[model samples]
Target chain A: MAQHSLEVIVENSPGVLARVAGLFSRRAYNIERLSVGPTSNPETSKMEIVVNLEGHALEQVIAQLDKLINVISIKEIVPNAAKAIVHDTQPDYQN
Target chain B: MSQMNGASSLVASLEAAGVDVMFGIPGGAILPAYDPIFSSSIRHILVRHEQGAGHAATGYAQVTGRVGVCIATSGPGATNLVTPLADAAMDSVPVVAITGQVPSVAIGTDAFQEADIRGITMPFAKHNYLVTDPADIPRAIAEAFHIASTGRPGPVLVDIAKDALQKLTEFNYPNSVSLKGYQPKLSADAQSILDAAALIAASSKPVFYVGGGVIKANASRELLELAQLLGAPVVTTLMARGAFPDSHPLHLGMPGMHGTVAAVTALQKADLLITLGARFDDRVTGKLSSFAVNAKVIHADVDPAEIGKNRFVDVPVLGDLKFTIAALIPALKVALAKNRPDLTPWLRQMNSLKAAYPLGYDTPKDGSLSPQYVIERLGKISGPDTIFASGVGQHQMWASQFISYENPRTWLNSGGLGTMGYAVPAAMGAKVGAPDTTVWAIDGDGCFQMTNQELTTCALNNIPIKVAIINNESLGMVRQWQTLFYEGRYSNTSLESKRIPNFPMLAEAMGCVGLSCDRPEDVDATIEKAMSINNQPVVVDFRVNRDAMVWPMVAAGTSNDEIMIARETAPDWDSQEL
Candidate 1:
């Protein structure tokens, strides 16, 4: 089991974050790092979440989160994909 | 349809959503919306408290299979709605709660009766909305209903600012919702169905573990067909009392906590457990470590998260309960035709266990009243059609254990939330939803106090739901726990006789016909009289012995094998092993 990261896009509606957070906490999954902000599209927001979980659990979490009414799309950050996102954001982190 | 203010638009939107009725109380901020309520086709039943409104909506939804609606004003009114919303969330009841906020300008200024209801109900509700613009009202209303009724049904909230309600806007309710992220998968794939079917066919002993989802999906027929095909015993959970008819040959009754010995034992011995629409709740599973340890669990539910939330399953089929069960039938039939395991020995063992550990409670010789006797007698008198609602505590457990339900959604109780005072309002809502059904609220004295004011609402609204409060004079369930674990030092659990309100008198004060019976003989006659009243609400106070406890309990966190018949007595099934 290793830490994984994903970028999620969702409608900027009230309680959307709570729905995702509540789902994770209900199953006792802890988010190691989480961040959400407005995306290029004003109507939708982007959320980045990092959690320590195995393949099956991560798949389940992503699938469940994707099913929320406000969620638009979710993309798991593969190693190559992670490097690109990191380079674009220019956050203080190195792979 | 026409240009109208936000309040008018809200009413029209509700009518379009097929909302015939709503349970709520209007106040300062919500008063604007009430202005147009009279113009709309929707009927409003004024409730005493917001919590009562929410639970009444839950009861209505549970019976009607529709999205239940509730309305409340700002601040405390919205705050009061929090409990029932949480209750609905946990139980997966479809409820849509609308609360009025202070004017948009004063929203964050802590203006009179203003509360961030969106933030407050966020964690508990499946979805919530804070409508700031008048034009968004119609869209918000449509989305709220869509999200509330779809997938795993749950509570949704829409907090409308007062100013927005007064703003003029063009009214046109949306025909469809566009949610990119939300898609409820309603059928299991072929591979999982075949796998589960093979397991069922291979098992010498199989148990069908059904829960409230079957009731929600209205899939009791499908569940029964599958159970029969597998020739398995069925263990219905508290929330799924009537999902499989209690009198059916396969029914083993409710399992866990205060569950029957046969039901628990059958599950313990099962080689395969096919769970439908139920989470492995601690109350049902007892000690999580050993629960259904010998069984290969196949959990089928609409909620993907629930598949492995508590107990890991060999097969996790994510889909709507009805669709999933229907799909399993043909596959199970095919598997059975190829090879059917001999279940004769398993059936023999189960029958003996049931006969030996049949649900039995003694009606005292010098006889004060037995709560179990009251429940069983009520069941016999009322017939199978009666809608039984219960508040939390010992009386609730007694009702679950003694009363037999023959149809889905007939038995209603706060299983997951364990909220007290749920019965009165819920019964009223159930009666409203299913007008022909005889509705009864079986409550405990301590629980009766929490929201009994709703009884007054029922009387005023002309909803004639009968209530039978088991007046045990103390918080019996807590007292039972205190007795078992705390050396019987009663503490504050006892309700002082002199200080406690006379329940019958209280019912009378609320404009209900009130009666009292402490004698076992009086139960039959008094209950007959209570059932005969068709024109008005009735309350029967059965002042039962405070010392009486709900038996056959697996003490909290204890394994099923450690189930107790009474305070210190191991159940017969377990005693055999010892």
Candidate 2:
């Protein structure tokens, strides 16, 4: 299983948060991190969900979540395998 | 246009949206909304409880294909509406629940009767809105009804703060709704339809697995046309009980746990399964791996999310079932003309299995009545279009097995949620929606205690629906589970016979006509008498054998091979009770 981060755009109506949270709980999907915020558009909200699942299961979860009436679109954020370069200007503590 | 306050605007929105009646209770917080209903065109029925109001709305929606509206106040009233909202969500029933909330200023301060109803109902409703501004009332209501009745129909909630209702604002109802993110899939792809048709034409062993979506889509006629064109047997799931006529030669009855042997075998042996608006629910699919293993499945539903949620599909056609099935009829006929699979052998086998294991129950030498016999006789006596609602457990199973449903929307029940107190309130809603039809709530003794207060609602509103309580004096389904799986522990399950507040007496106390019939000979006559009463609601308590259990059972989490027939389970049942 691998952790995948997904961004979901849905109608900014009351209870859309609960509906998303409920889908995770009822379907027994593992949620690592979840957050919701208003989009530039006043009528829509954006949700970020990090979940751990293998290939087919993740695809099914995404499909089911997309089926929700209020949900408009979903985008999976690909992981960056490349490491950030670190500056070694200071000497080691032991030295 | 006349100037209207938030309360007037709310009531006007309901009236403008074509809502004829609503079910709910008035409270201090929601008093503003209630005050205007007196002068408004919409009728309001005062319910004994808020939960009854919710379920009544569900019942109304289930029968009429309309968005049922319900009202309740904040805090306790809001919490009470939760169950019905969850029930509606699970069953995909269309309903709009409106509740009064604490004033915006005192919302988080925990004022009197203050509760976050919008947050509480978020998980269950299709969507919810909290209107703190009176100007948003008309638009919010229009959107709510649209959301509730659209694609995969479900409940929606709108919680208006008291301050919003108190504020004066000019009412301007929106003619159309424009929600940026709430678009439903309204059309299907032609390639998937043609591919599904191809699969159907190539398979000798084919079955049309129908469900509630077909009924919700109002595609029963389309379903029948397709079933006949395909020359395949049709097996409806519990929720789809009346979607297809039970008396049709190609109809194999209900499938899954507690379903008929023919229906189960047909689904098990089918080479191509055309699943129309039916989800592959755990109850319907005993073991996902083993269910229709050989069949190439075609899953057609309005909601794209349900396409591959459970079962892997060869063709996932997403659109409304009524339109899809109607389209599929001509496509299938064309395919058949070119190449048709010989289904004569498949038809013969289905008929033989049905004849061999036809649903049977013994007429006991003793005078005690059999619940199955009572239901079968009730079915025989009632009209073809007679409406029947059922509570959860063995009685629900028995009703599905014995009663013959010839038309859609005639059979209503809590299928997905398995709610116990559903029938009483749901039947009341059905009665209100179709006043000309005879509505009967076939309930269990244990289930009746959950929501029988609706009898007062029925009596007061002059809804002359009938109720039959199969009073076996125990939680039959739970007791059966304990008997088979828990080594007969029985604990806290049986509501012993001769208990206080007997159903008949309880019915009478609630202002409904009550009748009790313990003898098998009096079963038909009692139903006849109850049916004759058209002025007020009637409740009949049929004292059934306590040890009787629903057979053809597939124990939970088990495979198709684990189904226990009647004779195989008879010896162990009631062994500990004796």
Candidate 3:
């Protein structure tokens, strides 16, 4: 199944990470790549979450994620084709 | 444009990052940074020593779950913070240490009070920076915080030279940190989770290995659900002591070096080992090759590096434990329904093993008080939420055996480090972290006296942590070994003749309430009185039987099966004597 990436912006505070992670965890969705860091704005931080799921599963993940109060924005970041190719070239490192 | 000194800029950056407190002691080398400390909004806590500063910052950080900030001067001042820094690093506590170095020109010169701070801390710290230029101060502090708070969080040191602190620079704090090689893997492979679930379903005797990562990832609910669905016994690591409720029927206490016999046996007999968020430390795995010999290991951890670091992992699921557990639970539910394996016989055997090796103690019919009685009573009074922190030796083992820590993070001991004088400071930190929760420091006579000076710190901060000192009048754990292995040589282990401080008077001097329980009957009353008083710290000197020893002890350099079931009673002794 194809995996989709969801970029979410949340408030930079304690328990925010727990709440967002808890949401996906409660639904039993598999999160593939989750990278969180501070955004340009001081109050908000960007969380890049790549989840492995089909189209219907991706919609469910987005719908459930949108309900979180701290979530400021959500978008899909396209998987870098070059990085994927490089990873494929180095099959030894594949997890 | 007007330029500010590097120290001022460093202070400004820390203030900008919302750091309200800085813990440290002032010294000659770090005097330049001390000048700017008072001007900044960050409050400076002047500790008795740099070690105390490191511990205090650790306490502050543990409570807030933020990056703990501590400062010190070069050489000895910086060296004093080494123990606490190592403690933080080993336990994965987030800490940022700022040390003032000698002048940039004095590098490698070995001048008076000039030591290689960076070189000394390189092995210990998560990341370290040596800033000779004033321009690097702001960036260094920001990077230090970033590295300290990120994945597999640990202590980060920033050594600022005297010249850099005094030099002028245009200050600009980087709003964000970008490190190329420091990315923490936060997601698991979908196939790995499925494979792990499939393995769990197929195996008849499966065990869920829980650790501190479940608490860190906040995946307890997912873990509990999976364990319940699969009907697997949960064995926790020392660090993950309370991940599962100890009272639960399926929960087989802790496993490894000092683990319960039932837990160790369960791990040995299991066919599938689903390890969650636990690094297979040597303490947990006696012999790596022999550990879980019958089991196909499925290791799941947030840190990818820990996947195959210790044992050969058959299935590796690398991701946030909460996410991984959440996904694996449903898959396991489906797998369990399809493949129904009978584990009743295994569980019955485990139960029988537990019954055979029940943790017991023989209290003197009428003599000096017993530490076992005190700890057992403590387990009863203190709810599951209560946190029990202990120092090294017999008292720590007694606490481990007697206290049923049913919740995660409730029992904080210096397990890997075996650091003495850890209980009092760690309890102070746990109390600060969870003010509403009851925090007890179970210290031995030897370990209690090591850091009893910190009673003043507790009193000053109004941290009402209850301390129960098992006063055996000697180094009990070592004495037990000397008595058993060293043929009763009893060399320097005896503290019987050594003049010790009057604990009650010492507690009073530290401006805290004190109690002494010489009789087993007084244990309950004293502990109750201490718990009731919330205004200040309380110390209860539990004068236990000097000969009392921690039983079910697996002697050093011996296998787990060679456990000593009874203290004072040898293996070949007659059963009728009991």
Of 1 and 2, which scores higher on TM-score?
1
Query: Best to worst by lDDT, what's the order?
Result: 1, 2, 3
Candidate 2: true contacts recovered, fraction: 0.27
Categorize the docking of model 1. Answer: incorrect
Over B1-578, each residue of candidate 3 has an lDDT whose tens digit, in order, gives 34898888888878877787777877777888888897777777666677767766775665456777889999998998889888887777788999989999997898778888776775557767788999988888888898787666789888889899898998988989876435565767889988988888788888888877786676777888888887778888777777788788898777776677778767877888899988877667665545677888899986665666556678989888888999998888888789878988777777776766667788787677878889999888877778888889888877877888776667787766677887887777667667788888899889887777777877887778889888888988889878878998888987752246788888899988988888877878888898898899998888888787767655554444454567544333232111
Report the number of clashing residue pairs per model: 0, 0, 2
- lDDT of each candidate versus the true structure: 0.86, 0.86, 0.77
Docking class of 2: incorrect
DockQ (C-alpha based) per candidate is 0.21, 0.15, 0.02
* Candidate closest to the true structure, highest DockQ: 1
Docking class of 3: incorrect
Distance from true location, Cα of B541 in model 3, Å:
1.2
The 10-residue segment of model 2 chain B with minimum total lDDT is B569-578
Candidates arranged by TM-score, highest first: 1, 2, 3
Error of 3 at B327 (Å): 2.4
Estimate, for each residue in A1-95, the C-alpha lDDT of model 2 and write its tens digit.
45789999988876677778888887777789999999999988999999876455677778878766678999988677432322211111210
lDDT of 1 at B401: 85
Better of 2 and 3 by DockQ: 2
What C-alpha lDDT, on a 0 to 100 scale, does residue B502 get in candidate 3? 83
